[model samples]
Target: MTLPAPLTGVVPPVCTPLTPEGEVDVPSLLGLVDHLVTGGVDALFVLGSSSEAAHLTDSQRRLVVRTVVAHVAGRLPVLAGAIDMTTPRVLDHVAYVVEAGADAVVVTAPFYTRTHPAEIARHYRLVAGRSPVPVIAYDIPVSVHTKLSAELVLELAADGTLAGLKDSSGDLAGFRAVVTGARARAGITGFSALTGSELVVDSALALGADGAVPGLANVDPEGYVRLDRLCRAGDWDAARAEQERLCALYGMTGVGDRARMGASSSGLGAFKAALYLRGVIACPATAQPQVPLSEGEVERVGKHLAAAGLL
Candidate 1:
């Protein structure tokens, strides 16, 4: 299916379910996809940070895209993350994901080396030039080490280099700039400005964001979907209430001991643990190098789930 011009609503960055040996668990993955679909997500994003894309090998990434694209079967748009350290490698990922039937590709700025704004512009242009599907800029400074300035994003949007943006920078002001610019700018129709923030979905939507890409939605897709509906319905009170509930559930991310693991391990491990406790995924094992949550951490996750009424 062709991606919606201004893709809107909840688009979960799916978690990659892994076996005990760290192989992709296809059955669990498909079951998670079914859970999301049944819960009414607008779209699915695979091979993203939440999916542990950096940990997955080339073949694993390809399998993820193919499996999701085929299972989705055009029911909802699938946006695959063509994430790499440079443009050429990103282009290779773009080719395979598009060939696998992804509706669009999400990419981050070049990492591992310092880059200029001009270089970032060139990177997007190069990828867009070669991609068959739409290209959405993923402004995740925390991962890429370079925050995409609002000016650069608008410039890219104006020239048709970017179809949309996934702002995970935790900078609402910057995100608002993109949303307002997309609306006010001429010749920039159908450009989506989606927030990757789970805690502020209502606020982002209020500021005219097109939608959200909350990772927590993987554990409770119905809640996020409901939150999206409430916001769109102009029910601020209900939306805020729902958003707060999800936020409380998000506390699960902190259950892992900080001294033993980095934020990725704690965050991703919490997500996977919640999925396991909720029966969405078979195992809560995270990728290598990132520590898995201890049994106590998993129990804490269960408490968060139970408090959120997910248990």
Candidate 2:
């Protein structure tokens, strides 16, 4: 399906289900897709940070975009992450995913090599010029080590190099600047300003954000969808209550043992384990090199699910 301009509502950054030996588990992956569709997500964002796009082999990333696009059958937009270290590498992944039928591609600022603001602008313009579909700039400073300034984003949006932004920079002030800029900029119609902050969807929407790309929405999409609705409906009190509940449930990410693993292992592992416990996927295994959650951690995930009435 062609993506709607200013894509709105809940778009989950999907998880990549892995086999015990670390290959993509196609069946489980499909199952998780169905779960999200059924749960009422507006769109599916595959090969994103939640999906471990950086860790997946090129072949694996291709398989993921192809499988999801085929199975979805255009029910909704499928956004593939063309995440790589530089513009040339990102362009290669972009070619693969669009060929595989992705509706749009998500990319971050160049990494592994220090870059300048001028270089960043050139990179995105080059990408947008070549891409067959819309390119959403992913502002994930935590991963890329370079925060996309509000001025730079506005300049890009004005010239149409970026169709949208996925702001994971955790700078609401900067996010608000983009949100307001998108509105005031003449002829910049249908510019999606989506937040990657799962913790602040209500606030984001309240401040004119087009939508959210919350990783937590993978486990309870209905909650995020409901939050989106409540925000749109101008029911701020109700939205706040609901967003708080989900935020509380999000505390499950802390269950994984910190000393033994990194944030990815803890956060992604907890989400997969919760899905397995909820009977969505056959297994909770994450890709290799990321430690699996211990039995104790799994139990903690269950408790979070139960507390959220997902168990």
lDDT of each model, Cα atoms only? Answer: 0.96, 0.93
Put down candidate 2 lDDT per residue, 1-311, tens digits, no spaces. Answer: 78899899999999998888889999999999999999898999999999988889999999999999999999999999999998899999999999999999999999999999999999999999999999999999999999999889989988988889999999999999999988998868889999999899999999999999999888999999999999999999999999999999999999988898999999999999988998888889998789999998999999999999897
Candidate 1's residue-wise lDDT over 165-271, tens digit each? 99999999999999999999988989999999999999999999999999999999999999999999999999999999999999999998889899999999999
lDDT of 1 at 299: 94
TM-score of 1: 0.99
Please give the range of 10 consecutive residues that has the lowest summed lDDT in model 2: 181-190
The lDDT of model 1 is 0.96
Regions of model 2 farther than 4 Å from truth: none
Q: What is the lDDT of residue 141 in candidate 1?
A: 93
Q: At residue 133, give the lDDT of candidate 2.
A: 97
Off by over 4 Å in 1: none
